[model samples]
Target: MENLERTLSTWIVRYRWWFLILMPLLILVLAKGLDLRFNGDYRVFFKKDNPQLQAFNRLEDTYTQTKNVIFLLVPEEGHVFRRETLVTVERLTELAWQIPYSLRVDSLSNFQHTEAEGDNIIIRNLVQDAPGLSDAQIARIRDIALAEPLLVGKSIPKDGAATIVNVTVQLPGIDETGEVTEVATAARALADEIRAHSHLSVHLSGMVMMNASFSEAALGDMDFLIRVSAGAMLVVLVFFLGSFGAFGTLLVIAMSALAGMGVGGYLGLPFTPPSASAPLIIMTMAIADSVHILATFYQELDSGAGAKCRREAMQESLRINLQPLFLTTLTTIIGFLSLNFSDVPPFGDLGNFVSVGVAISFLLSITFLPALMILLPARLPRFQFEIHMMTHLGNWVVRHRRRLLWSTASLMVLLTAFVPRNELNDVYVHYLDESFAFRQDTDLLDKYLGGLYYIDYSLDSGKTDGIHDPVFLHKIEVFANWLRQQPEVNHVNIITDTFKRLNRIMHENDPNQYRLPERRDLAAQYLLLYEMSLPYGLDLNNLINVNKSATRVTVGIQVLSTREVLALEERIHQWLSDHEPALVTEGSSPAIMFSHIGEQNIRSMLGAMTLALVLISLLLIGALQSLRIGLASMLPNLIPAGMAFGIWGILVGEVGLALSVVTSMTLGIVVDDTVHFLSKYLRARREQGMPSESAVRHAFSHVGMALVITSVVLISGFAILSLSAFYPNSGMGLMTAMILTLALLADFLFLPPLLMKIDKH
Candidate 1:
């Protein structure tokens, strides 16, 4: 190992210029190749065989196959049963169907009105096909809507102030961004038209609209985050180093980021919201590694040694720093790789992409950074002010080590105990900040109409012919009733009860026929009659299945916190178990599936992170060849994460899907500080034969300034990310910054004090 180190030292001194030119060119070529080949889709989060996804696909295939967008309309004053309201509803309905890529459109005006005939129920379009309805005719339609049972208090608000017009769109494929954009634009345009022509106000809310809004927000935020983080880091580097040499270091870090991102792009990996931040993250991490090496390199050259001095400096720095740098990179990779356990596709992609990026940064820092240093002048630029500040801070740490240790420990324990454990959720509409236009529009719709988030339960009886049986119908009715009683459930739609009332009304208002049908055949006959009388666009697919074995009951839910969603789901599950024993295998809506997957992701990510930490800890022990030193090294790395989480729990109350991954990430970042501190202390003891306390002071005096500066750079880079509008990215940035800062303190104060206490043994 000594001979190899000496050989590498000689090469760095002799052929530095060759490495500097070749290394950067090679990186640029690789980056360009990857950039030309990159793909950018977000659906890669779900596994191909995910059961929930498969069930959703099945429903999508069998039922009305179209992507849907909902238009929620409201009046500022009075009920919607007026002639003016009915006319406006009809006009919007007509324009909505004319929208490009729209397969079908349904609103209060176009709803199928059903009534029982002799022995069956007859259904017909509420609005007849005509160029325009007279004012009197429109008034008559309004009166009928006010009197109708289902249309009265359900489709339209009970106050009659608001109503919804849902437009179902059929596109060629999910990736057809053009079609999605067109539909969203048309929907907004129609809303504008209604506002201009009439006094009525319209708000658009649905999956497609939300998706488009999210995509736009994500892209904009990505640009802002990158520019802000890079710009801030550059300013800091310039302020500290005060030379063109800082720019060269910055170039090396930038090259590392480009290489990492280009590799991902070359592999055809599309950048999702999380993955988009990988380049910035790679740059931040690389800066820390490069800054440390450069600081030591400059310090050695300032001592006024010759070629031998420069050669020895590079060797000593590399020998002392290499293991710690490698360990930090490995831990970071492990933490990021843990994200693969997340059910969310974006998170999984982020983990893989970042892990690869960190590896690239490590390699470039070792090879490219040294080459650049050798190519630069021996007497490089200096930061006299920063050097003075670091010296004073180092002196303070040595004096007050005991007090700092106690204070840190107490704060960590207090925060950990008080931290909240509220569940994390993904309410699609709520993901956007309040300042966004989409959020404002969605909020308005929810206040006037109902919320967009819903839980669709398809109750399959496992027998096609028995769908309309009295037992099954009664079970569904009871389940719907139970759901309505829950606070989370805003609306419930059960076709059986809807038609059963219509059948009773047609039987000369007889009380005997008011209840559910006794036989399966009678129920089937009633449904068949209703289906035949329905309009062209208004189909029975929303309420009934094609096989007739299962019935779909949709329960619209109000937006709530993640805890509320989980509690609501649990309550519904328990209610079903108690009331409907035979109603087996209930498939939930897309919204509910998102919440489930988020919760699962948190658990999986935590498990993976814990495993990674354990593996990293084991690796460190093997590398040190001393279990005592290895175990001692863990306190600086591990405690910071616990402290960060504890602080997060106290301050934030609830940690989400993003925060769950932070623990693993903190493990990797903190390890950098530990490795640097411990490696220095060990060398002072075993190689130079110093006592433990002398060794602690020697190690701190030598590497302490560089460690402080590197932490500052890392913290500054991550802190800029807190400005991001995206919740997950911001959370990660804040937590990572906090953890890195705490790790630096721990290494400077706690590690030395603890080591002092241990050496007494």
Candidate 2:
């Protein structure tokens, strides 16, 4: 293997021009294949086959789609009923209909306010002709709005300080990014116009705005993070290598990143926030490959500057680096590929793209990087200061190996104790940082109007038109009343409110008649008359099926942790089973889907992570050709991840869908230092017949500098991700960096002493 790699490196140097031109040209061509589109829909997180997604889709197909953009209006005078605030609400309500893909617009002014006038039933807007609202009329509107079940805590809070305009959208499921942008543009323009005219503040939020946050954040990070990372890497590389060398290596890395994103585009993959970080991640991984090769080559080349010495240095670096590079890349690929086991599509896509990128980095490291270094007219930079520092660090570790090992081991155990402290929690709204408009606005709305999390359920009756059955009506009313009593439930919307209201209106506006009809015939007659009176799009069809066999019940609740949410769903299911078992339904909504996905992803990733660990362990055993060494390698390989999670448990204490894949991600990255160190150590022990102590020194001397350089580069790259507005990417990036850093420490401080103790003479 060494001879073949040396020969290949020499041959590439011989025909360096062709190699340089071809590699870059191929990168450009592959890069063109990337489609580069973003998907803002939260559904992008789940695969089609995911049970939670399937349930949500089924519900959407049955009833109306719940996608919407909400505008929360707060008057400067602290009253939505004021003449100016009422006018602003009316104007925004009218303008909201202009948003693209808008299906229905709901606000206090358009709430279909119903009341009794003598023997007649009057149906009209709650606050029409907004400019003419007298104090008495305003009081009446507030009274009606506060009493309506469908409006309170929905379009208007009970205190009447803030009102919301909900614009429900119906997407065609094509070019959704563009549709979201259009709606956002129109919504923002409307908000600004209203804010300028009226003294009130208009904050925007909702499902549609949430989706736009995903899309915009992806593009924003791609634009800002990629550039930030590139510049940062270049600066780090320039200090390690000279300007010319840094430029050449960065070119290889940039091409590698482009190639990875191109693969996603070529495959027509959707870029969610998780997948959108591909370019930055690929760049980080790719730099290690080039840096290892260049730093090693420089070490040998520095001994002599003549052409003959240059050839030998290049040859030696190539021979020495090939196996370790290939092994590390393969492990990384395996780790990322394990994400295929995830129930989420974005994760799977992320795994696939990164695997491709790691492979490309290995290829470029061996071919393009070497050829560029050989052909580009550049002088070697003096890095003896760095090499000397690494040497001192290695000698220091060897001198106090015993103390270092015990201390680190003890620290790791202490950290491990915190692993169980972390609880799984995911609130989709929190996925974005407060910098985003949606997150900020949503927080204000939650503070004023209860909560936005909703559980959409359809209680089924087994037969068509069975919703008219007195038994079904009474059961639904009972369920709603029971829901209202729950502390977590903020508001409950059921058809019983309208049914009771209509009953009272029919009996000369008598308050005692505000109850469900005792017979099915009377209930059916009242429903028929009410349906006939309502306008086209404002009917109950949005909440019921065409056959009327089932009716949708929406329960609004505040955001809760994954465990709390799952427990709530289970309790609701149990309640229906204990009483009215036939009315049970699987809860379905965006919030419900995300809540279940985190748990499913964690369970699914357990098998994938175990398989990844096994396969990597086997690879170490086979590649190192030492059962004892390979088996021991498992400790460092396994402990770093455990220690990282333990540390994370103490520091963060909340793992979400993104963090679930941390084991698999860090599994591969952490193994790079291990493979480099162990493979070099074993070679010294077996091939050179060195003592265990000497072999450890040889391993450090050979690859220690490269490890430090790569770790620094890798750590810096990941730390930059913490700047992302998207928390998943931020958490994943920061945590991976932490694990990788710990791996370096374990390999350096722990592995050597353990090896000495085992292989003692």
Candidate 3:
């Protein structure tokens, strides 16, 4: 392997001209396919066969698709019943139909109100001629709406201080990416128009707005965050290398990123928030290879090798770093490829893209980087301060080997103790920070009106039109009543509400008659009469299927954690088992789906991580040719992840979809420091026949500065990602940075001392 490394380095310099030209040309050709498109749909988070997603799909097929945009109107006067506010709502409701792909629009002014007059049932818009309504009429409207079950918590709050105009858009599903943005844009424009002339404050929230925010966040990160991370890498590069020409490192990384994105494009993957950070991540990971080679090259040059020996210096640098770089790249690719085990498809895309980029970076670092360095030679000033600091650190660790090892081990144990504190939880709306309009509007909506988080159940009755049976209606009413009693539940929109309203209207408007009809025939007759009287777009299709075998019961919930969401789901299922077994069905909604996926992802990644650890350990044992040292390397490699989670548990105490993948994702990265340190330590012991103490010293002096430089670059790169408004990306960034930092410390502090004690005999 040493001879092979020497020969490979010789050839890389001998054909430097060819390597520099041919490699970049090949990369650019591959990068030509790097046409990335953005998709922000919530459904993108789940696989096609994901159970919760399948349930949501079935629910949509049975009833109206839940894709909607809600415009919340908060009047300056603090009441929605005022004439001007009503007019603005009425106008917005009318114009909302103009939004692309709009299937229906529901608002205070367009609420279908049913009443009885002399044995005749009258159904009309609740707030008719809003601009001409008298104060008495507006007061009546408020009184009736506040009393209504269907509209109160959903469209209008109990206090009637705010209202939401909901536009239900039936996207063709053929071009949902474009259609979603179109509807969102139109909705925003309409809201802006309303705010321009009315005292009402308009805010938009719903699935459509959330979807649009996903696209906006991805595009924003692609535009801004990548540049920020690159600039950070640049500063670190210049500060360490002490030369601007060290920028050739950035070019190698950039090409690697471009090639990675190109692979994603070639595979026809969409850029989601998780996957959008691929470029920055590829660049960051690729930097380690370049920094290792460059550090060695600079060190060789500072040994008084003249400019004429620059090629020899680079050749020697490549020869030393080749094996470590290859090992690190292999492990990183393994770690990221493990993401394919994730329940979320975007994460899989991220993993694949990055793995490919890391591979390309290895190829470039060995070939293109070496070739480029010879062509444009960099003259780095001596990093005496950095060198001396590493030397001092090594000597100190050897002096207090026993004490330092114990302390670090103790610290690792203490941090790992907190790991169990992290609970699996996801609140989708909170996935985006308040910097997003959707999050801000949704937060306000949760505060004043009710929850955007909901659990949808498609209650099946086992026969056609069975939903009209008095038994079925009674069961639904019981279930809805039970949900309403739950503290986490804010409102329940069951078909029973419409039935009771119609029944009371049929009984001459008597409040005492507001109950389900006793007989199935009577319930059927009442449902038919109501359906016949309702206007277009205000029919029962959203709640009832054509055959009426099942009905959708949408239970509005508070902004609860994923744990609370799952708990409510369990309670609902348990209640069905106890009281209404035949009506049992899996709850389905974006909130519920998101809740399940986070836990599922964690489990999947655990299996993948176990496999990766085994593969990496075996490879390390083979490469280092020492079974004892190989097994010893696992301790430092594994401790960083546990410690990172422990730190997260102490600070946040919650882990979700993004956080779930952190362990597996950081596994490969943290190993880089371990491999470099252990490789050098073992070399000193075997080839140079150094003592344990001397071996530790040699490891630190040889690879210690390089490890620090690379870790700092990687940490800063991810730290910049923590500033993203998208919380999943931000949390992953924050946690990954923490893990990398811990990895560096473990390698520098813990690994050295442990090796000394173990190898002393």
Candidate 4:
């Protein structure tokens, strides 16, 4: 151990400058190279072989091979079903089909209209020509729309408030971003055309329109986030280090960030929304390490220390800081790496990228920072204000040590009770803050139109030809009716409902006959007639399986919180158990999958974090060679996270995918304070043979200022991130800053007091 110390000391004294010069250059060169070649896709979040994706893809490719978009037409009141509205819908439907990627278009006018002709019904597209339709013909089209099976409830609202004209594009490899923009532009143009010629109001919705809005909003916010985070860091650095020194620190941090991201790019990683914040995270962590080293080095120089003093400062800082820094990095990596277990690809990539970035920041901090300090002037302006402030703080901590302990312990214990259960929810839409335009637009649509959340139930029977069976159809119809009655369900679409509705229509809209056919043969015959009457592009592939053994039922729900979603899901499962036990299995949809994933990740991550804390404690105990000391050291590190999380629970009841990871991550960062404080306390005790109380005072007096400065820098750096619009990133920043600040307090008061008490025993 003595030789190891000597070797570390010798390296710090002799060759620290070399690390400064080479590190930055190496990072810059590598980063640039990697940035030139990176390609990542957002769809990677779904497993490559997901059955839902496969089924959706196959169905999308086959009959509905057209790209679908919805134009929401809302008149200024009592004008949607007028002749003008019918003409506009018919005109846009025709023009939409002529668009480059469009293969087909379906609106009130173009939807295939058919009726059973005895044993068979002929299926054909309606409205052969748009401008050719007379006023009487257009009236007939509107009448057909009101009575159509799928088009009736979907396109024309039951309340007769709005009308949706769906346009389907058929082009492959269409630039998703570009296509949305083009279609939106075209829809707006058509809306303007309608307003010019008639008195009607129109808005757009559907996958294409939503995707366009989402992309635009995400891109704009990303730009703002980058500018804001960078600007905040720059301001903080200038305030702490002054103008000139701040520039150097900025350069170091910038280099570390670039290098980290560039490395990711080089490794063929794409820049995802989650991983886009990589540079900011790396920059914050790097600046934190730089600030600690520079602050301490400058302090020593201001005190009239020469080359020997500079060398000693570097050696002591490293000796004091190395383990803490290493531990922090390790904990952060573990926290991020645990994301690999997540089913979501973006989350997994984020975990891997951040873990790599943290490791890089750690390496550069120790090597590059020392080197930079050597290269720059050894003398720095004396921080007269800070020194006096820290001195006062140190003296106060020593004087009121006992009182501080009780206050801190009481606060921690009280907060611990509120640390909300590690329950998580995967509401992806909620991931975006309310302030975002996409979220605002989504809310408007949900309020005016319908809910955004959707759940798809694939009602499968073991045997083929079971779907057309009347007994099975009746059960599905019963289930659909039950769901429709529930307050949570906004809409439930089932094939049986459509078939029964068609049967009612076939029987001249008789309410009494609006029920399933009694015999399987009659049901099959009715389905065959309905299938033959369907249009060229519109088909029943999405509603029923090829062999007719399974059917898909979709349910849409209004905007709800995570807890609300869980509750609804539980009720749904219970209903399914009581009603159709074998029909539902892992209901597939973005909402359900995300909710399950979020819950699993939260539970697993919490378990892992607990294991990590225990393992870290064991390591600390073994390293210090005292069970009591090792155990005591954990309080300072452990309490901060618990306190912060508890406060978070009380303040923000919902913890999402991001906060789950923070638990393990904050553990690593907060532990740095404990390790630094305890190392100093132990050295005073075992090496210098000082009494416990005296050693606590001496240790605090010697290293207390460094601890305070480093903690402040870390806290400030992380606090800047709280401004991010991304909830996870912002929440992480706030939580980490709070935990670190509490860690400093624990280190100064509770840690030493507890140590003194233990030593007395």
Best by lDDT: 3
| 1 against 3, candidate with superior lDDT | 3
Model 3, 376-468: lDDT tens digits are 746675767778888889999999988989999999999999999999988889988988888989999998776588888889899999987
lDDT of 1 by residue, 301-359 (tens): 66554445555676666666676777778877887777777777677677776777788
Q: lDDT per model, in order?
A: 0.71, 0.84, 0.88, 0.67
Candidates sorted on TM-score, descending: 3, 2, 1, 4
**Ten-residue segment with the worst summed lDDT in candidate 1?**
36-45
lDDT of 3: 0.88
- Tell me how far candidate 4 lies from the true structure as C-alpha RMSD in angstroms: 4.2
Q: How far is 140's C-alpha from truth in model 4 (Å)? A: 7.4
Winner of 1 and 4 under lDDT: 1
Q: Write the per-residue lDDT of candidate 4 for residues 213-283, one digit (tens) a residue.
A: 54554455457655776777777667766665577677777777777777777777755555655666666
Greater TM-score among 2 and 4 belongs to 2
Question: Candidate 2: misplaced stretches above 4 Å?
Answer: 117-120, 305-308
By how many angstroms RMSD does model 3 differ from the true structure? 1.3
Q: What is the lDDT of residue 314 in candidate 3?
A: 89
How high is the lDDT of residue 193 in model 4? 72
